[model samples]
Target chain A: MPREDQGPLLEFKAVNTYYGDLHVLKDVNYTIGRGEIVSLLGGNACGKSTTMKTIMGVVRPTRGSVTFDGQPIEKLATSERVKRGIAPVLEARRLFPRMTVYENLEMGAYTQKRGAQFDEDLERVYSLFPRVKERRNQVSGTLSGGEQQMVAIGRALMARPRLICMDEPSMGLSPLYVEQVFDIIQEINRQGTTIFMVEQNAAMALSIAHRAYVLQTGKVVLSGTAAELRENPAIKEAYLGELQVPAAA
Target chain B: MTAVDVYLQQAINGVSLGAMYALLALGFTLVYGILELINFAHFNVFMVGSFVGLGMLELLGVMPNDPALTGLTLVGVLLLTFAVTMVFSGALGVLIERVALRPLRNIRGPASMITTIGVSYVLFNIVLLGFGADAKNFPSPLPQVQFAIGGAVLRLREILIWVISIGLMGGLTYFVQFTKMGKAMRATAQDPDAARMMGVEVDRVIITAFFLGSALAGAGGLMFGLYYNITSYVIGFQAGLRAFTAAVLGGIGNVPGAMLGGIIIGLVEAFGSYWISAAWADVIIFSILVLVLVFKPAGLLGRIAPNKS
Candidate 1:
């Protein structure tokens, strides 16, 4: 494939990831352009989380390269990758339970030097999630599931990331929270941050994502505009839980 | 002297002894909090640190026969010896982690823990071979002043131990609670992978914990020598077990808990020695350890977590 005038912000070229002898991701290739929301859709054990981990440098690619901002960062540590502007809102909202809400946000900016800019970013996050500001002093472990999700997103935003990789943003959230969370995702993207999301909620993910990829058993089985995939019969049948029988059969 | 006054004096002695144990327990807790390794070699580190403090004092011209150095000069000499001993012990801790523990980090099971036992033996033999098996008298430079508060006598050496240990503990608390690196250490302790995601260097955090823990233990060693006026290669085993018991009593990973546990153990030992026989102190302490393990396995401050082990 020929390169565009402005290359993709993040790219995975034939990436293969493994956990010991168990092969998780095989020859996976995808790209997220700057300011675009890319959703990776998959079922259980389809390597969606592995893809996110590989991008964040938590899981290294055993074969192939992962490029971020046009730089090959295959061997970089997770902290180094964060320095290169990648921040992850990990699966299951792994907050430091003992720390207060404000402290959790402070930790998100650990890669950056402390100064005036931190307060500015903090205010930005606070403005985005007023609830997080209200309960800033409370221990994070004591927060409700929906409240914890808000803080988790607020924590990731404190990094001032150019590209945010959110793993299952809607997991364990109420319907009201899921809608609010997706709305916030769009708002975040509109303000100029590229998003690479791994989601099991195909319907909600496709609704906001500009481009999408369907992964199956460690391979990119389908890729197209979100609009096109939303209309595809195969996607609706498999992921959307809709039965599509051959009308002519 | 009434019975009340004697018990009061014993209580004061117990607090001073407890402060020293708290220092050692803090080291065990810091390293164990981050790595989940018992660091059995920390006992030897404390032993080595006492020897190093002795060496530093000798180099500074403080002799066994020399008159007690008073005023600012005594303060300066003590500070200098503490600084050198702490740095030496802290570096030794880092070296042990890098050499013995780091290699076994990725390997599952008790490889690193067993390695620590091996290291404890190596340091024990090194000290034995270098300094001989007999206990050496540790000379103190503080003036022999006795003061009484509410009919309880307190020595200058005991006062110094309390002051230095409390000061160091206060400093450790501030570092962990307020500073950026301290926050990283806490974050790493809570969830290392999440901390890594937030750009905290887990390796550096681990190193920092080891350094801080070992340095505190080093300070404790100096205090132990000053208070007991004795140093021996075999001292590490007994002291290490007591401190380890303190850590478990307070809650293994909890910082404030370790301090409390150390003090309690010290008090128990003191009271046991005074009330019962001196030989019964060890029996009582180990009995407390067994009772705590059986009843409150999570310790006085530790939360019950099914996943911790």
Candidate 2:
């Protein structure tokens, strides 16, 4: 939990994004406080990924403003936004597959100058994921799904970002990896980097998130603390049912 | 000359000829790797480089049939000409990308490609009007020196071609392999959207690709001039087709593939001309292109990428 004296670390005020003429995110509002783990929860095609894109400046919102740490960042370029300390762990663990694991981690700090600081960050990431260190010279594409996800998270950490935005971090992972990924996410948040994650896994997302927003068809239908949303029967019916389906079997 | 000597001489000629194609093919592959657009106008950039080199040489007081200067003076003039011509052609490439292709970036498909063909025509006419239709005598300052290796004659131009082209290729390889911008370029090629999320300046990378590719084309133009001692607007079309073929033969988007493809095309053309006739050389090269496309569409070094969209 962060002190209430300061403003939210990231704030999206009525942001609406479009792909061509098709509206993908409709007046979406979100607030993530400093050192907090905020999860954006939604089903497929519900604009969850678009929200992440908006944060990273991959997709610009036609209307509304996004502020980070008291600065308006809606008009900034993606690289400029990254220099302002925002980094993304893209969907499907979009690591540079052809590059070696070490190279991929090097790219994570693309916005920063290479020096002792880079070496320190690399050391830190290695400590967090020993497997990443062991596979440093191997090509990233050959890594298994779980390992790739670990590398992806390690790659984002290389940026030394103040806030890391992750999109569907658990997608395509085995159940065992899923729990491990969630544990890492929690551990990362505890280390003081704010996280804003988008997940289709409602049960898993709400389990570790401090606060969460539920989205459906480009709109935020509900927003509250994770504990409150977990007990909400409506959310359980809409999203948590995914976990329930397998459990019922 | 003995049969072995004849083959050795052709091999020498082929390698030198292939050096120019390798440079031009790199331009094509670099642009295609990033934009997936075949810059048909790139050949004309090479053409412009020839004229620009000629103009620079003239400005430096070197004229046709001048006493071929040797030693440091020749090297100095050559270096200056190469630098100026490359920068000129590189700027032209950036202009083409900025004015012609960048606007149509959002609206995908054949629009930008068709626009490149249009730009090619525009460049062709501009050069045609600027330097007449006749073949311009492009002079070289190098002393016409030749040495024999095992009964096969080799010239200074051939060695210089090999050295310079190999040097440029090696430099490009090092840059792409070790540099930060190079990593970003690779990342952009693999996945543009994902790269953007990483804070890569995607547009700047595209511009850099155009600049580097065009600059290489400029160098190729100068090499063609130095090798053949003549250049014209028609050369871009004739040689551009050959370079384009090299790019496709090597696997269109593969950098090293382009280099290998160019050399093979050069050797094939050399042998085809010697064994058959100069007129049939082009037919043989185009046939290789057709065969490669039909059998191994990915080229030798290219991998078949699954369609992302």
Candidate 3:
């Protein structure tokens, strides 16, 4: 891949991630340029989630490099990576169960010192998520799945992240909530924050994504502009469910 | 004194004793809350605190028969001793976490508990070597002043002990409830990986937990020495067991539970000593612990979670 005069905000150069003998992600390579909504699409167990985890340093890569702003961060701790402007809205929206929604947001700003800048980011998140403000005092565990998702995104935004990596934003939500979530994601991107997302629902993901990658097994099987990938015959048959395929492996 | 008066005195004594147990148990439970390990070395830290107090008192020459020492000067010395002991014990706790417990975190085993037991032995032996194995009388520096309250006679030391315990617990409660670091500790305890993803340094939280808990244990030990006038290296084993029992009684991981548990245990021992026999106090407390375990395993304040697959 030829580098633009300016490097990508995030890049995985031939990264191989494994859990013991189980090769979860193999020779994975992709880059998210600045201010891009880059979505990774795949079926369950196809390593879409693993790609997100590797970037977050929850799961380390066995080979190659993961660089953020051309700085290799594969060796960094998860919190260190997070401090370096990458916040994860993890799968299942893993909010602190007993903490209030406000406390959860506070935890998101743990890397940043408590000051004027912290207050500004917090106010911005509350404005972006008026519903979260409404449920500020409520415990996170008791929230509805959609509300929790809102909190998850709002919490990530509290980190003042340069690039927010989301693992399955549409995990257990109605079509209405999914649509609302994509709208918020687009809004966040428009505000100059880059997004890297993994989604099981390919059609909804591609609709908002500027660029997208299709993951199969441990490999990125397809990568292109969202419009180009959406028009690809294979993507229509496999992801968008627009065409029927012959019975095959 | 009448029988009712004696019982009232016993109850007061029990409450005071319970305060010390509550302090120790709070520290014990704090460690268990974050690391899920019994800090077996906590009592030793307490013992070291007692010695530290004894040494400070010796340096200040504030003994019971010291007529020349001013009350204000004695108070200053006492406060300085506490500061030194708590800080030292807190550092020791952080050291244990860094050198022993933190390294064992990645290993999939119950080795942390065993390592704590090892730490307990190491601390015990270190104290034994530094101070002789024989019991050293902790000279109560403050003048023996007793006052009657509600037909029960109480010493100045007794009242001061209760005040100090309440103050420490209150301060701890405020810190945990209102501070950012405290919130981070709670988040890390609930889910470390999630907390890290949210940019919390999990290691710092664990260190804080250990330091706070051990510092409390140290203060408890110094107070115990003052109250009982007995400071021996082996005292830690008995005190640690009782404190551990209190933590279990209240719910091992719950902070308020530990405090409640400690007080209850102290009250039980006090009443049992007065009503039954001093020898049977241990047996009575253990029986109560057995009953509580059989009935409420999550502990008195512990929340019961539904079964997880």
Global lDDT for candidate 3?
0.86
What C-alpha root-mean-square deviation, in Å, does candidate 2 show against the real structure? 2.3
Assess the local accuracy of residue A87 in candidate 1 as a C-alpha lDDT between 0 and 100: 89
Tens digits of per-residue lDDT for model 1 on A164-242?
9999999999989999999999999999999999999998899899999999999999999999998899998888764
- What DockQ does model 1 achieve? 0.74
CAPRI category for model 2: medium
Better model by lDDT: candidate 2 vs candidate 3: 2
B198-304: candidate 3 lDDT, tens digit per residue = 87777888899999998998888889888987788988877788888999999887889988999899899989998899899999999999999899988899766
> What are the per-residue Cα lDDT tens digits for candidate 1 across B1-309?
788998998899889888988999999999888888899999999999999999899899987657899999999999999999999999999999999899888898999999999999999999999999999888779899989887888999998998899899999999999899999988888888889899998889999998999999899898888888888998888888899999999999889989999999999989999999889989999999899989999999987772221
> What clash pairs does model 1 have?
none
Q: Give the per-residue lDDT of model 2 (tens digit) for B1-309.
A: 899999999999998888899999999999999889999989899999889999999999988889898889899998999899999999999999999999999887899999999999999999889878999998877798999987899999999899989998998898788988888888888778777777789998998899989999999999999899888888898888898999999998788999999998899889899999989999999998999989998987887882232
Error of 1 at A53 (Å): 1.2
The DockQ ranking, best first, is 1, 2, 3
Q: What TM-score does candidate 2 reach?
A: 0.96
